[model samples]
Target: LSTTTDNGTTALHFASVGDASVVLSYLTELSTLKEINQQNYYGETPLHWASFTSLAHVKILLKNGADPTIKDSKNNTPLHLAAQAGNSDVVRFLLEQKLVDANAENSCGDTALRVACEEKEL
Candidate 1:
């Protein structure tokens, strides 16, 4: 009953990016591989989408065993994405993990906090 593309972009990804409620039936109240937050063609994990979009999936995915410190091919972590997106909620949640590098910079020498500040000022 799943309809994902070649790269394995599942319903979870859409739910994380759009209507989270759209996946509650499949994500919540269950513990299956459906909860597996894998990467896409862009090397972006489910946490990346969740964070990048500033969706509540931050805590949801973490609670479901998502790694907060996982990075993408561009050396950008979930915290980095969230920061760039200016989602204060996701940033605070990631900070609470105590595992993220507050000064962790990307290949472009941009840290999560730095990107957050820069994007906000823009």
Candidate 2:
């Protein structure tokens, strides 16, 4: 159930990037919620991609137990990616999660707020 592509991207990642809500639901049903947080070669979880792709995808992943605090290879959480990508809704949603660390920094020592500021998303 943890099958992935060459880069370690699982079906959930594809579904999230494509915003295929039905496919996502089906995949979730076929697999366990733990699969929802599968990471790619770069350590980017489905949530990381979803944060910049679709809000619905993010919501589905979160509801299925995806950890918002999970970091990628660069040490950037889903919230950091969302902020860096200027996804205000994703950022806001992530901030609402109790596990989300708003002050969490990436490998570069940049927080979500700093990323948002650097990206001129403020």
Candidate 3:
């Protein structure tokens, strides 16, 4: 139950970052569903890392009860990170969540839509 890296990142975070779906599945079985949303030292949850990289991991995390609205230390939600990363698919999935705040502003006062627009010009 105490397994984690120096930054407090769990195996789940590594699984999400590496796109290790099978590892994620097994980890979920061993850990509680709440662990799926555990944050690291940067206050980034597994979903936050997955949001920019894998739509499949995003879906899996959400399905397993990851909270999309949980903010990081910078007050950036999963949707916020997805938008900043220009991940349209992950943004769409996060928007579909009943708890998602589309207009939620981060510490910088940037909403997901605003970030998406800015990212488009880059």
Candidate 4:
């Protein structure tokens, strides 16, 4: 949990992107919110990566202290990325988490609802 790549990408981030929920859960168990929510060069957290990977992964990360409301460098929340990825289940799950700000806008002033509509999932 103390290791990172040049971009500050931790094992949790990689595992989230790879949809390795088991590994993510294990790593998250050994991590604090600061470590599990560590952002990469792009300011994306494991939850951000998992938002487009797997709902199961998102759930694990969320249950393990990953913050659902963190914004990336672009100010896009996990909800935005999930919507952009057309992961309806993930988008729904994220919204249900309630910690996420559905009204939150990105750098382009686009809300998660707008992003979902753009992805044709709304």
lDDT of 1 by residue, 1-122 (tens): 25567886766667677665537445634535445556677777777888876556766777777776667888899888888877777788778768588888888899887887888821
Compute the lDDT for candidate 2.
0.85
Q: What is the TM-score of each candidate against the true structure?
A: 0.79, 0.91, 0.89, 0.93
Of the candidates shown, which would achieve the greatest TM-score relative to the real structure? 4
lDDT of 3 at 96: 73
Best by lDDT: 4
User: Taking the tens digit of each residue's C-alpha lDDT, what string does model 4 give over 23-58?
Assistant: 878888888878988888898999999988699998
Model 2's C-alpha root-mean-square deviation from the true structure amounts to 1.4
Ranking by lDDT: 4, 2, 3, 1
Off by over 4 Å in 2: none
Steric overlap count per candidate: 0, 0, 0, 0
**Rank ordering of all candidates by TM-score, starting from the highest:** 4, 2, 3, 1
lDDT tens per residue, model 2, 1-122: 58888999887888888846888777777767678778889999888998986888888887788888889999999889889899998888777765598999899999999999999975
Q: Pairs clashing in candidate 1?
A: none
Query: Residue 90, candidate 3: how far off, in angstroms?
Result: 0.8
**lDDT per model vs. reference:** 0.72, 0.85, 0.82, 0.87
Stretches off by above 4 angstroms in model 4 are none
- Which 10-residue window of candidate 3 scores lowest in summed lDDT? 25-34
Q: Cα deviation in Å at residue 82, candidate 2?
A: 0.4
